[model samples]
Target: MVKVTFIEHDGKEHEIEAQEGLTLMEVAVKNGVPGIDADCGGACACATCHVYVDEGFKEATGEASPMEESMLDFASERQDNSRLSCQISVSKKLEGMKVKIPEFQG
Candidate 1:
């Protein structure tokens, strides 16, 4: 299992043991992590699952695809480290990784 941490805008944290193939959004939704709305249900159609990948884990999480980048254009408070959680597949490299949920979604 890959251990991941979701930190809400208010600083609430949800640490979860996630399956290897699941996306960060999937793991958050499954474990009831607040702020990850995931309205598109992993389809990458919306920005509701926006998150900021921790600087240390950026390479492991990788760059967002053009489609995801376009969708992220609709996300609120987007930053250089911002990412769509649904676009990030969890893996061993992501163990102990942390992502911060924005105060609001698109």
Candidate 2:
């Protein structure tokens, strides 16, 4: 299992043990992490699962695809590190990954 930390805009942290091959959004939804609505159910159709990938884990998480980039444009408070969590697949390399949820989703 990979350990991923989901931090809220207000600084609340939720650490979860996520299974490999599942998306980060799935981990958040399964673990009941607040702020990750995942409205499209990991379909990458909505930006409700927007998150800021921690700089330290950026390499592991990689860049978002063109489709995901287009979707992120709909997210509120988008940032350089902003990503649609549904597009991030969990893996052993992401064991210590950290992502911050936005204050609001649009």
Candidate 3:
């Protein structure tokens, strides 16, 4: 399991032991982490699963693809570190990664 943390808008933290081969959105949704709507179900078609990747883990998360970047345009409060959780696969490289959920979905 890859260890990851999801920080809620109000600063609540959920530490998760996520299975590899699953998307970060899957981990959050399965763990019932609030604020992750994931309406597109990992299809990269919506911005509801948006999250801010922690700066320290940026390289591990990698850059968003063009499709994802276009989708993120719809995300509310998008930032430099913004990414769609569904687009981020859980892996050993992402162990100990942290992501912040915005106050609102797209």
What are the TM-scores, per candidate, against the unseen true structure?
Answer: 0.98, 0.96, 0.98
lDDT (Cα, tens digit) per residue for candidate 3, span 1-103: 9999999999999999999999999999999999999998999999999999999999988889999999999999999999999999999999899999999
Ranking by lDDT: 3, 1, 2
Per-structure clash totals for the candidates: 0, 0, 0
Residue 28 shift from truth in candidate 1, angstroms: 0.5
Clashing pairs in 2: none
Distance from true position, residue 26, model 1, in Å?
Answer: 0.4
Instruction: Estimate, for each residue in 2-59, the C-alpha lDDT of model 1 and write its tens digit.
Output: 8898999999888899999999999999999989898889999999999999999999
Cα deviation in Å at residue 24, candidate 3? 0.3
90: Cα error in model 2, Å: 0.5
The alpha-carbon lDDT assigned to residue 84 of candidate 1 equals 96
> Which pairs in model 3 have colliding backbones?
none
> Model 2, 91: alpha-carbon shift in Å?
0.4
Identify the runs in model 1 with alpha carbons over 4 angstroms from their true place. none
Poorest 10 consecutive residues of model 2 by lDDT?
55-64
Q: Any idea how many clashes model 1 has? A: 0
- For candidate 2, lDDT tens digit of each residue in 21-41? 999998999889999998899
